[model samples]
Target chain A: MAGYSSPQEFVEHVLEKELSKIEESESDEEILNKLKGLGYID
Target chain B: MSSAAGLLLLALMSAAGLYFDGGSGQHLAYIGPGAGFAFLGSFLTLLWAFAVSAATMLTWPVRMAWKAAKRRRSLKKARVKKLIFVGLDGYDPRTAERLMAEGRLPNLSRLAKEGSYRRLRTTFPSLSPVAWSTFATGVSPARHNIFDFLNRNLKSYLPELSSSRVNKPRRVFKIGRYHIPLSKPSVDLRRKSIPFWKILGQHEVDCTILRIPITFPPEKFNGRLLSAMCTPDLRGTQGSFSFFSTRNESVTYETGSRYPLQRSGNVVKGVLEGPDHPLVPDAGKLGVPFTIYLNGARNSATLEIGGEKYPLRVGEYTPWVPVTFKAGVAVKARGICRFLLNQTEPDVNLYVTPINIDPENPALPISHPSYYSAYLAKLLGAFATVGMAEDTWALNEGAIDEEAFLRQAWMIHEEREKMFFNALDRLREGVAACVFDASDRIQHMFYRYLEGRADGPLADTIEKMYQRMDELVGRVFRYVDEETVLFVLSDHGFGSFRRGINLNTWLLDHGYLALKDGAETAGPYFKGVDWSRTKAYTLGLAGLYLNIAGREAEGIVQPGAEAEAVKAELIEKLSGLKDPATGETAIQRVYATNRLYRGPYLEDAPDLIVGYNDGYRTSWAAAQGIVEREVFTDNPKPWSGDHSVDPVLVPGVLFSNRKIAAEDPGIEDLAPTALELFGLPTPGHMEGKSLFQAAAPA
Candidate 1:
């Protein structure tokens, strides 16, 4: 919550937190497999 | 990354027909109202971010110097360094007093003893939206232009979202079957007066406002804010949950949609409805196909959606799943929803939460600065973005049970706590405020359990929520120092909605409202009503509109003296209405809006606001503009409690860490109080005084 100088730095920190959750829950391979099933990716 | 350049590229690519295929011969795409805006909005947001960053770097020294000068001037006569408002929506004074007497609410009782606790006067209708609007602007509903949750479209005679209005792009480029919108859609915040935070921002005071009602399409100011009530889901509705089941029953729900799924062996397949496909002409709502693999022996399932598989157990909810709806080759709208596995063995039933605009890449502006929501999502992971995040409608419709609903409510509460604490920890000066709605939602659904003696674990649900909120207050108290001023308050209190009074039915029975010939029951929005002959009608939770000349589309009653006479007659007849079933008075009084509100927008207010007696409210049918056969009926829905009664019966509780000399402080008083705390004078248009002041010499 503190020590961030700019809004961009603050935003990047938040993005890191959000992206970490996605990585923790499901890997890229799992997402790709599911996408293949839905015809979103080959 | 300029918006003009982006629009030019879109036009050129669309003209080239790059993504068009010979699927239906027409290359027309239909984007849902919200999805189209999201695509354009996100692009513009990115461009704006880049511009802002560059501008900040260029003017860093000048900005810093200016801020220092402004801060010195702003804090010259300040009383405190920080002011915090903790809003517990629908926290009743009576309930708090009872819990304090029992010594169950230690923190609140201690705060009351040390400072001040009193009953805060609520708005006429005692509604959250109306009262909170008053709290933000220091004005009545007439000045704020928010009388109820819904307002009638005078032209169409249909109920529309009152606080925010979204308008589609009027000008479009028509090329063959494709209609490309050349202009961006506009979303307007309809609340009339300026919020106090904006005034505070003008004086260089930093404020972090979280989940305050009527703040959707967050206004630009020198502070941060996340909107609350009336913020629509990704689908451009308040909140619409999807229930997938294999049952043959076709039922209708007030707020949610049910999709019948066909199960084959152990596999059940269904399509999750997404935003409309923007590139396809005449295309209905877009759908994301999903597959559920049921493990009947284990009572578990694996739901495969958007190329991701989530494990779900019976009575358990899956974490939010990010969904992408593709409209064209490069056009995709992002949203998120959670999945709850309701049943699997006898009949497969899966519940999908309302698709909230992904905070990381929001479709609409749900926070001030536009990037604030994205920053929160990046900071704390994804959270509920819809204003009314709790699925009260799903529980009321019997789609999800009480336990499932409670879990959802608590999860939302946890998210709010994170955001609230984040603000408090970061903000050393200025104002920090956040409102928790679980207190309101839980009591609305669990008050019935308290009325009747039951040994079920869920019977103590309301009491448990109160205790949890008390713990939250204790945490907040620990964070506050002498330099900070804290205020904990609610917009209104709660009362049981045991019986419903259909005002339309009463009007029909009393010959005030007339329907078309041969119509026994009037449909929603008064479809069967012959407005030419109709004198009055009831449409929202508490509104009663008269068909007056020069106002209504089909005016019958004249305005001025004639309208006054009609209002008087209706009020005299409607007041003290009784329910035959229980032989109890259903309506306590009826308020004439003209008399209660004195502002420019008084004409827009409903002619009469029904103040129902405790334990009674406007029926579901009446709220939807239906004239039912019976005037009185039992409210068997899970949403068994409400505060839309007489304002006197549901006075909200207000506890301040600082002593307040004022008695009977209304919600409107808080806005001016916040200004005065910051050493700023209240605006001339504001109609409220500071709560803390010295007594006059006797």
Candidate 2:
């Protein structure tokens, strides 16, 4: 948060960090869903 | 003048003299002695040529017409309303003799005593596919090109399971060499090959062939045939029929519905009912609990799952009671669910018999190992790459449970026999050629009995299996009558093998076989091969070839000298290799490829064909194997026995109600004899002479 210039940027950075952590802890099914959300599959 | 021309001139002068003299005898004196003698010689030559031409012209067409007439006469005499050919595969005469002596197989024994029995000499390799193909084609293996189960890949020096057709080019093309057609003809048909069934069919005999092995993609014929490619394993498919009933009301179960039951709540529960579907209309009785006897059906309907259709049928019968359908109760169903409902639109409470696979003996989970012996290592190896890695030393020889395997095999044997005997009872007409494979399969797995391996797993069951087969044979004899001609045959005989030699491996060691860049893959020879030193090599089908000059692609061995030298060297080397324990010769015979293989596909056979001693056999995939020890071990697997040696001793039995002379018969003579028995003329084209006259006592 300290590295970011604006509140919005700081919020975005924190959200991205949390998302990566969540992905790491996700199961195969959850990861599949994430990939589908990214348009990897129909 | 030349002798031939002088003779021609003299004959012409004499003809002119005779013609001028009005065909009178006085013209002979008028021509003078010299002219008369010359004319006589020329006339004799002319007569000879005319006679030869006339004989050649008369032979073929007249013979063919006579044969057709004979076949017709035979059919008429016998008035063959129906003809049945029963093929009992791998039935040994020696065993039959023993069984008869023991008072077992009473019916078969009686048939043998009353009927004429003769031993059939099977085609070379004596393997099932080759022998059965010959039985179908009535031709030798050489003509049929079905020498063994596997054909040799000349380029790779590897063996592949032989097919009815060649998938790859039989020979490699070389510059400036004639493109010789080296491919073997397909075994199904040949100009000379005459199938016995085709003859019967031509005569308009209605025949039904049941369960003859290897008749897949059934041949085109007039007869109605249910090709028995094999006695198919019926455990997985839902071939059985089932039925269901409801009392007083239509309990319509929708075309597609799920019925689930839970202990908490459900409807009226009763025994699961009748055949899933009615084969015979009105086969089902109207009762509360329908009694359904599931007789196995060959083919049936399918179930729709999601957007796709699943080909699942009810395999066998399972008893189930109707349960009240509810949402909570349905959720508990692990497997597929069926519904039981009262009459509604589209028959919601209708009795539906859905076909499905038998849940109990589904397909066996056994898979042949991808790499022989290597799979055993991978399965046993427990550790990562280390010295003789833990996994490498590990052996998963199926937990080494020999007894369990034997028991399972015996159980399968019992079921197979039951099905076979039952099928025999059902068939009233048509050919019933049933094959009993238990004899062959069991022998392979349990030959250790004769090998003095006491207290083996099958010790108790082996004799029992034999006794059971004898009983089954007895059962078959009961149904057969004087009209039936039973052929109990074996493709080949079996013997004990002590050692196996990998011909490819041996060649690689001796540098006779060249490898690619230090790799074991067979590559282009003569490019990196040293032909000067290599004397002998071996390949499949016991084919041995010499490095003859002008014959090989790169012939370093001089023509005449090399052939003899190579043959002698090979014979000495192969014959010298003996089993360490037995000190007996490992190889009994090594035939030269050309000498043995006269078929067009001889080029595809091994260069040096080796016939191992009675007890030994080349491994199934010998070329791809690593020859670590000289002879690592004898066949220690489940298939300890093989029929690659001497032919099996099964003798074919022929019977007829009509009194005929007793004469010795060969397999080839069967067709001609059948024709003669029917009072038909034996076909001139047929090589087999008739046994009719001899059938009568002298």
Candidate 3:
């Protein structure tokens, strides 16, 4: 159990960890505004 | 010509529409002025958007389930939860050691003490594209098919971009005077082998790769990647800056174009050329006119482009200005550029950096998933999309001063750092990697300053850049946990390019290469060379190709034994060649492709790869096949540092958070090592070994 025996187990472990985090998706307009603020886009 | 007259005409047209044939006339009743066309276009756009959104919404659950399943299956044999690769392109091990010994780079020294650091062997040519291709694919340059940035087309003997090929759309519809492309133009990534991320993605391991060289037209896999190095500007070249001046000098710059601007009453106008119009067959390169209005009192200027005005102070760079080229109705190509007001008084000189493909509206594919670049643009605003974004050529040609060049480099570095940190924050269990080229670019432009030979104001630039990179490393260390493994490396080290050896002239002088009658020298691509009598030719950074009978168009040397004998003779004679000025050996060794490479594409490689000693490299003219008068000349350009020397002399540096068992790790080793770290077996096709353990397939 110290290391994964197959790729499937590793995926499950990663999915479990990913599921624990909060997910947020920003809209295109919002991303553009942020970029403009950062002086990367005008 | 008047609004009232237009309205009257529209009214007459509306009345005439009612007289059209029977059933068709009923449909035509809704056509008034331009409303019908606008309504139809908006309706179609809305309909398509609705359909796509509905489909995505309905399939979201199923797609999520499938991805989760795939991820679980791929990560089943995983060993590490997270892997981070921090690439400092062209970071020199010798300089790092010197600084570390002098107690200048504390963070790197601490990292070395806590974990491990060693010299990482580079590829044969030690070029960025070749070395990074090997790093990504875990193979030699022959296997990856990226020998150099420029590869000669044997048929025409013209040099072309090696990593990617962009072809115009094959099908077009001609209507009256307009030629509209009926299909999307295709961009092909020419690097042959699969990148390590694709292999990892197949195993269901998610990856976020940023700005890796030779990844232009990024390949599709289970990852997000931003392409780097070899990505062309909007004008379809590596990097070409535009210089506008009022000085009546017909000077030709090596890497940039100088245009004479006509000034009338404190106003100067110049045209900024973008990519070719995709919809027009013979429209040539589309150009947008810009005007600079000089203000002598304040020593400032106002730049007007595309109806927008920006204030420009002398010796100051304007922010990224978006430029649009109109191709046809509803067709516009966008790119971004920065302008520096070099001077404003007696001779107005303005420098415009090459217009990079706008990440928000890229004219060509610059990332995978197609939307990945757009997403990053949205996230970080607009960042550099052109490969080799630092504008070293501008600095080399004296179009921009040292301060301007350094400012541009660090600004790009800051943008890369933002994206890198964002990926790190998001990747909890997958791979996140980014390569910072500031170290490479700064070293390239400032090594002469560091060597105490050049009289420049920025002598400590290289040291400052290294310290900044160390700070970035320290920041990375703070973000990783026990489950995370970090790897910091460079593609190759750097050395001073003091002298340039024009191998073509040398070959011409030695009677190995031939020219036409009454022609003592030739221009680029051996224009005047008589190929029938020529036995050898040199093109690219370190390539020497023989005029083999079967392979070349006008080859004189026979293929089998005769070619081998010629190669042997050249190699023996060229190796250990000395510089007459200094009496120091210039070339260390000359390697035959057959002996150095063992891949199927070995035949496409250069017949001989030259390995120059430190402080020596191929001259600028020689790289383009130009035969100069002298065989050797002092390198006078600001690009005073280089790595296209003997591979042994420019070994890259590698540092890791974990102990590496391999005594001597090469750039190729990192790809296989990434797979091993994730508990996946190294594929049989890969020529590299894992640095941690023997993960060869049973």
Candidate 4:
């Protein structure tokens, strides 16, 4: 828990370090939303 | 110790392989059945400690000269020589008024009678982590970035601990079914914004902060600190106790570990679980074998654990017993637990407290100077290092009764009092603040008795808790003088949780949330969720999230106009929602996060905060990301009280031994107040005015 002097510093660390593993996979659900939110009823 | 000195000690410890106790922040895998580790580095750690002492001794004069000059300059304009803050978590103002009128809380009443008392405004969503973070940083929840206890890992749509993150060991050597970690897990604090203590530290103001929630993995500062809430136990869970029974019936308590005692001729045996095997992921948990020999009369027992023997009296708790879990050759994870002999007659029913991470040989970075926790353990005795060590859940689950819970909570309280008072005596200057959770935990478990929901022998528990806190304040009065400023406050207040409002179920019913095909209900973490069709959903206790396209990984709703429209619709429909069972309004208000907060992290905030009415809270199901079939349920659990509601309904109580102050104060204001008392200007980004300072001429 090293001290961060400010929020900007913490944010930079998060975006550049912690969140470097951004997902690239696409969801079929997102495509279904484009087709008028079709057939998602359970 | 000073910040520079603390950093030096931390470096020495890190160099000596005592860097981290395995940064398993809420990672339950490591603390499965038995695995605790330390001895592999104990000799090196000891050697480093001596070397650092010698190095510090040699460097003292020059370092002292520099620090003394900085302190003199910082204190030149100081308004007070010393500032002390006593935090009584969840101490309600309404209850205090009633008890003070009854002459039950003499010390708090005296402070109000002689000085000042005000209803302190708590943070939005009214949670300890959020409220205490604001108190520490003098900022909005968006600024501190601790809006809830659990955060949704957007990629997986699962809940993870929000306060801290412990990355897994990066480098490992695999050999014959074992993965020996070559690197320690990198532990990081997730709470944003600079705490006022860090600011004070920059000004050469030494402070001691103790048991403040959300401060796990204590950061380096120009002061001493012992982490509090969010510090997990050796089993890497929040607080999971173990129960050994001989009923031969398999019953699982949600919050406890259940093990059957092997009984043969009055000799019972059970394995005490520790952390997972450090070198082998699939090796299960490292365990310690213990034997309990029942007395001939079958009323008492003698317990043997960790190569030591102690007599266990019926319905009595044994002193903290040290246990070592062997992970590998020369590798051990040390921990301590208290055994309670519930019964020994017909069967053996023993309750073992959650194994707290050994303070003397912690498996995590729980203190600022690194060795400060061990120092305290050496000075005092082994104290509970697990966050939420009071184990309210054990009482709620009926694993332990009222008396046992009370005894355990009070024992932890005494341990805290010792450390707090020690800090006060030694802190002749700078700031010293300590938060006591007994006030919060006792009320959470016993508020039912106050509400007359369940008649119990400990009906007067809440009053007794308030009295105990008052006695504590009276003791603290002795340490305060003319040059010292004492301010006592609570993060939030308490209320009965009579009904739980499942926002997820409501969303499902309202067609805002959709499940997968053939699914009528979702398991924990939204197992059956259709993320795209789910325009609006809820997770965690205090928030409703919108599945905006760019925000969440599987989001469907478009940001801006579409998201706002969904938020507005949910707010309109949910506000003042009535509970059909109780025939009462369950929700008081709905707050749009964008309107409520303005900061860098506002986008990360929950889209809509559901401010339930005083007697209502987010259902346990909703908090765990489960979509149930029903919207409301009567909360029958022993944890009958909470503070997660409209902030206005549960303002915390504040008492100060000073004559003049603002008519109202807030958890955030205390940070600026502490800064102003030290004659330091509050940072411009801080959204608080000094409580002791009046408004400027408009």
Which lDDT tens digits does candidate 4 get at residues B40-149? 35677669979999999999999999999999898788989889999999999999999999999999999999888999999987989899999999999888789987
Taken over the whole model, the C-alpha lDDT of each candidate is: 0.80, 0.39, 0.79, 0.80
Give the deviation of candidate 1 from the true structure as CA RMSD. 10.4
Model 1 Cα shift for residue B473 (angstroms): 0.6
DockQ ranking from best candidate downward: 4, 3, 1, 2
Runs of candidate 3 with Cα error greater than 4 angstroms are: A1-42, B1-56, B175-177, B260-266, B279-282, B694-698
Cα lDDT of model 2 by residue, B294-369, tens digit = 1223222232322333332233211222211111101110011122222222211222322211112111111111
Off-target runs (Cα >4 Å) in candidate 4 are: A1-20, A23-42, B1-56, B696-698
TM-score of chain B of each: 0.93, 0.53, 0.91, 0.93
Candidates 1 and 3, the one with greater TM-score = 1
Give the lDDT ranking, best first. 4, 1, 3, 2
lDDT of 1 by residue, B1-698 (tens): 45455456566665555423213323323234333422243456669989999999999999989998998898899999999999999998888888899999999998899989999999987988899999999988877889988777665566667787665655665554444565556677878777889988988999999999999879999999999887777666677789998887778765677888889998899988976555444666778889999876657888899888999898998988988766655456678999998888678888999888788767667898888998898898899988888888788778899999999999989989999999999988899999899999998888888677234879889888888888899999977889899999999998988988888888888888899985768987787999888899988788899988767778899988888898999989889988888889999999999889787667788999999998998988888788889999888877878888989899999998889988768898999999999999877778778999643456
Question: How many Å off is the CA of B644 in candidate 2?
Answer: 1.3
Better of 3 and 4 by lDDT: 4
Candidate 1 vs candidate 2: which has greater DockQ?
A: 1
For model 2 the local lDDT of residue B41 reads 34
Model 4 docking category: incorrect
Which ranges in model 2 have alpha carbons more than 4 Å from their true place? A1-42, B1-74, B77-88, B93-96, B117-119, B154-158, B165-194, B224-431, B454-457, B508-577, B592-609, B620-632, B646-698
Candidate 3's displacement at residue B63, Å, is: 2.7
What TM-score does chain A of each model score against the native chain A? 0.45, 0.42, 0.41, 0.36
True contacts kept of 2: 0.00
